[model samples]
Target: MRAFLPLIALATPLALGACGDPAPTYIDQAWIRLSPNKDTPSAGYFVAHGGDAATRLRGVLTDYALKVEMHESMSEGSGKGAMMTMKPLDSVDIPAKSTVAFAPGGKHLMLWGVNDTAISRGKMTLTFLLANGDRLLVDAIIQKPGADAPAPKADEHKDH
Candidate 1:
């Protein structure tokens, strides 16, 4: 066993190092679509990538907007008669090594009264609060409403 002592020491450190660190959660492709009507709330979308361990998205906060809330759209009925409804979400589950998208016609952020400073800068910083007590600050591109803007989908409405 004496001859194997040095080999064991070398292998032990490598094994411990491999198990020491886990991937961290992160957000990307964040953007917000401005509302033509000032009274209407603008919508925000992003993709959240889960870390090595599972966690929950508690909430999102931003200083640039007067209010920010997490919401999801759902269809109450089927076919042409289907009605789209939105409900506020307190938290969203994020599984390990998974990706959750906040896209149009699905989960999204509602922002009211976005400050002109952010609109002028064409970008804004949003804070993501996770259940693991990790607060991630991410920048989101701002898309202004204009002729060149992408047309809204049938399911996407201005009611929110």
Candidate 2:
């Protein structure tokens, strides 16, 4: 009974795994919330995945602003409410089987001159320039600061 149980456990997994499952497709169109500030530029965050091999981000650009720069946020000062300073990043790399997270109060995309229009319901296209010169376009949805907005549904995104 003991030997039979071990074989069942191992064989079950192997048999199920042999169903010819395709490799996972890389996740695209990831994002981060854009926190608001009176004196600072707006930031956009997201994750860039490198599915099978290493990837490097050379730059990012968007028509919504004069320039798009990669920046990292660092916490300084004392106490629990330590002030954070966002510093510019030269470049970013996503190693093989890895991802680069762009989140609030962390490494984010710095957008300058956000335009006069409201961000509550507008679409912005962010072009990510990779080290290999491959540019990926992701449509970023804008929302009000402090409002919790869930991710878009699958039906909203269909291959055209």
lDDT of 2 by residue, 1-160 (tens): 8879988998998899888543321335444355477456666777676645576888888776666789998989889988988778889877776667787767888776665453544657778887766778877766556766546467543331
Where does candidate 1 clash, by residue pair?
none
- Residue by residue across 58-94, what tens digits does model 1's lDDT show? 9999999999999999999999999999999999998
Cα lDDT, model 1, residue 143? 92
TM-scores of the models, in the given order? 0.84, 0.66
- Consecutive 10-residue window with the lowest summed lDDT within model 1: 151-160
C-alpha displacement of 57 in model 2, angstroms? 0.8
Question: For this target, which candidate reaches the highest TM-score against the unseen true structure?
Answer: 1
Q: Each candidate's root-mean-square deviation in Å? A: 7.3, 8.4
Where model 1 places Cα greater than 4 Å from the true spot, the runs are 1-4, 146-160
**Cα miss at 124, model 1 (Å)?**
0.6
CA shift of 89, model 1, Å: 0.8
